[model samples]
Target chain A: TQLLEQSPQFLSIQEGENLTVYCNSSSVFSSLQWYRQEPGEGPVLLVTVVTGGEVKKLKRLTFQFGDARKDSSLHITAAQPGDTGLYLCAAPSYNTDKLIFGTGTRLQVFP
Target chain B: SAVISQKPSRDICQRGTSLTIQCQVDSQVTMMFWYRQQPGQSLTLIATANQGSEATYESGFVIDKFPISRPNLTFSTLTVSNMSPEDSSIYLCSVSGTSAYNEQFFGPGTRLTVL
Candidate 1:
């Protein structure tokens, strides 16, 4: 089985600060997806990185896929209090529809 | 994109009881997945529900504990049987997209507390 581990299990920052979270895997994958989940809600898809070295941006957030396709990162610029949530990275399980999710990063931005 | 919804947003139940959560999608999907998450943690996939077959559970989960029913292309149900404190968590319903990248959308989740 493939494993995904995320770094900096918890993060707390003041509003307007910038931060980055990472997700690493034990094996290469075809694609990777990023999600942010707020309290009482399920995770919402943020972006999907299909190719190695791919980068996608959503408003103040930026996502990058490692050149080897074995890792990924999410960068938040000028974070706001609304950005506080649990961030996760996931990939399809060997071409199957099932997903294997990351350990998770909890970000709290206090305004 | 597929819009997903789950029933019984939050429920507190007694031990040894059972709870059935329903999931509905606005559009047809090939596979629907069930996941469990702690209050402030990540997702752990429980099983994959296909329209016309039995659900495929992951390693740590069993059918007896999480019986799934996919009655149609756009609806599914997950039941937590003989609940215990350890079963207290958020259960989410997800459906895979048809894109080449295979994006997935999630429901609002059902917060379950077994006391």
Candidate 2:
């Protein structure tokens, strides 16, 4: 099975703290995407990591893909209350155009 | 990227009732999908709705339980039939992005609560 296992299922951190969420799988993927979802809303795409060992940054969030293409990480620097949400990583299924999501991580940043 | 909207943002329904959620896209899309999300859980693909064709359901989902309609490229609907407490969830509609990567743009989602 192509499973994206995420670490630290739930996290609560103080404002301005740094945190990192990991997504790992036994199967390799050509690319992976990270999404954030708030209550009563669907997930919103955050970033897509394609190349192995590549890193992309968007303001306070940084994304990194593993060299083997089977893992990824999302790091948030100086997290604020607005950063609180459920974080999910997803990749294409083995032989379909559909996406398979990660286990998920719920983050809560307190001021 | 496409901007998507869903109708009846949230609803409370009785058991054995059905709820139809509407999704409208700002542009034409070839691929649209429905997903279900339980509280504090990940998304599960319910089915793939393509215009002018039947919806392809996922392993644990069935058309009779969650019927879908895609009469055109810019709109679709998902109906949850014979709702039970277990059927309460957040239903989301999404379209495949116009990128090489498997990117998808999602709607706000419909929250359903069955009592």
Candidate 3:
């Protein structure tokens, strides 16, 4: 089974602090995606990294895919209380289109 | 992007009972996916529903326990049968208009609390 492991399962940061969440895997993936989920709602897609060593930015959030395509990272600059939520990384199955999600990282930004 | 909605956003059900969650999409999609997420955990794919065909379940899931239906591209349902307390989790429905590596839109999850 291809598993994606995320570091720092829980994070509590003061507003305006910067943080980075890591997602690592041994198996290379064709693509990787990051999502943020709020309570009582489903996850919303943040970014998708398809190429090796690719980086995409969405306002304050920066997402990077490793050179080997086996790992990814999400960085938030000056995180606000609205940034607090569950972050998940997912890799799509090669044979089919099913997504295999990573161990999530929960972030709490205190105002 | 697609707008997906799920019925019964939250439900408290007794053990041994069953609950079926409905998913509706704004646009037609080729595939609809069902996923389960334990408290504070990530998502696990349960099955893939295709129009006019039997749903394909993942390795640890089965059709009997989680029967799925896809009458069309824009709608599907997933039923959790004979629920146990351990079955309490957030169930999500997702759809992708593009390939697997592309973006996917998810519905507001159904939070099932088995008592």
Candidate 4:
């Protein structure tokens, strides 16, 4: 079974602080995605990285796919209280449309 | 992107009871996925629902416990039978986009609390 492990299962930081969350897996994936989920809501797509060593930026958030396609990372610059939520990394299953999600990193940006 | 909606946004039910959650997508989709998110945990894929076919469940999940129905391309239902305290979680419905890269779009999610 393929699994994606996330570093720092929980994080609590002051507003304006920057943080990085890593997602690593022993198996390679065709594509990787990042999602942010707020309380009482499903996760929202943040970005998708398909190529090895690919980097995509969305405003204050930057996402990178590792050179081997077995890892990814999400970095938030100057996080705000609004950024507090659960961040998850997911990859598509081989020969299937299903997605395998990481354990997740819960971020709490307190003011 | 498709607009997805789940019925019974939140429900509180007694243990041993059953609940069926409905998911509707604005646009027709080829594949619909059901996921479970335990409190303070990431989403785990429960099964994949396809129109006119038996739903494919992931390992550790069985068809008897989680029955899924996909009568059409735009609608599906998932029933949690004989629920217990461990069944309390957020159930989310999602669909993969038709583009080259299959990006998933999710519904607001149905929060289930078994008492």
Candidate 5:
């Protein structure tokens, strides 16, 4: 079984601060995805990284896949209150439609 | 991108009773997935619903407890049987895109509370 563990289960930061969340695993994956979910709503896909050592940025947010495809990271710059939510990293199961999600990192940005 | 919607956005039911959640997609999809997210936890896939076929459940889930029906490409339903307090969670419906990336899109989610 492949398990994904995230660092700093809870994060609280002031407005304009920067933060980075990490997702690590021992098993390789064909693809990796990042999602952000708000309270009482389903998660929305932020980005998908399919290549090793690949980095994609969305405005102030940056996502990077590990060189070995066994880990990924999400970095947010100038964090605002609107960026507060539960961030999750997911990987597809081998030859299956299932998605294995990470432990999750809850971010709270206070103004 | 496909738009997905789930019925009964939130429900409070008594233990031992059952509740059925409906998922509808704006466009036809080859596969629809059901997932459960307990309070303060990440999402766990319940089953994968395919058109005209029996749903494939995950390791910890079963067909009897969580029966899924996919009558067509754009719709599916999931029933939670013999509910308990532990069964309270948010149920989400998702579908994979037909693009090369196959990114999954999610519904608004249905929150179920077993009393």
Candidate 6:
């Protein structure tokens, strides 16, 4: 079984601060995705990293896939109140057609 | 990416009753997935809805409890049958692009509250 563990399950930071969330797993994956979900809503895909050691950025948010494809990271720079939400990492199964999601990190960026 | 919509954004139902949530995607998608998210917990995949074939459920989930149907490439439904208080959660439907590895777009989600 492949499981993704996310560190710092909950985080509270003031505006302009920066923070990073980590997602680690024992099994390698072909691709990994990051999502941000607000209350009473489904997660919206932020980015997908397929190549190992790849880094992608969306405005102030940056996502990185580990060199081994077994870990990933999401970093938010100069956080704002709008950045407050739940961050999730998901890796689609290689042999099967399913997505394994990480534990998730709930971030609160206060103004 | 696709724009997906789900019906009954939030509902309150009695235990032992059932509720069927509908999912519609803007574009045709090959794969649709159902998921459940309990309070303060991560998402858990319930099943994969196939266009023409029967839905494939994951462990700890059965068709008898949560029946899913995908009649076409752009739509699907998930029925929570014989619900209990524990079944109260946010149900989301997701659709993958052309390939399984493609990024998935999710619906707004149906928040079910079983009394």
Give candidate 3 misplaced runs (Cα > 4 Å): none
Candidates 2 and 6: which is better by lDDT?
2
Real contacts recovered, all predictions: 0.86, 0.83, 0.78, 0.72, 0.64, 0.72
Pairs clashing within candidate 3: none
**Residue-wise C-alpha lDDT for candidate 3, range A1-111, written one tens digit per residue:** 789999889999999999999999999999999999998889998888999999999999999999999999999999999998999998886687777789999999999
Tell me the TM-score of chain B in each candidate: 0.98, 0.98, 0.95, 0.97, 0.97, 0.95
lDDT of each: 0.93, 0.94, 0.92, 0.94, 0.93, 0.91
lDDT, residue A3, model 3:
94
Runs with alpha carbons beyond 4 Å of true place in candidate 6? none
Per-model DockQ: 0.84, 0.86, 0.79, 0.79, 0.71, 0.76
Docking quality class, candidate 5 = medium
Tell me how far the alpha carbon of residue B110 in candidate 3 is from the true structure, in angstroms, after superposition. 0.6
lDDT of 1 by residue, A1-111 (tens): 799999989999999999999999879999999999999888898989999999999999999999999999999999999999999999887857677899999999998
**Residue-wise lDDT of candidate 6 within A55-89, one digit each (tens)?**
99999999999999999999889999999889999
Clashing pairs in 1: none
Give all TM-scores, in the order shown.
0.97, 0.98, 0.96, 0.97, 0.97, 0.96
Q: C-alpha displacement of A45 in model 1, angstroms?
A: 0.6
Instruction: Give the candidates in order of DockQ, highest first.
Output: 2, 1, 3, 4, 6, 5
- Candidate 2 or 6, higher TM-score? 2
For candidate 3, the TM-score of chain A alone versus the native chain A is 0.98
> In model 6, how large is the Cα lDDT of residue B4?
96
Model 5 clash number = 0
Q: Give residue B75's lDDT in candidate 1 (0 to 100).
A: 99
Cα lDDT of model 6 by residue, B10-60, tens digit: 999999999999999999888899999985569999999889999999899
Can you tell me the CAPRI class of model 2?
A: high
lDDT of 3 by residue, B1-115 (tens): 8999999899999999999999999998998999999867788889989899999988899999999999988999999999999999999999985754756789999999999
lDDT of 1 at B89: 95
Give lDDT tens digits, candidate 2, residues B4-104.
99998999999999999999999999999999999778999999999999999999999999999999999999999999999888999999998878789
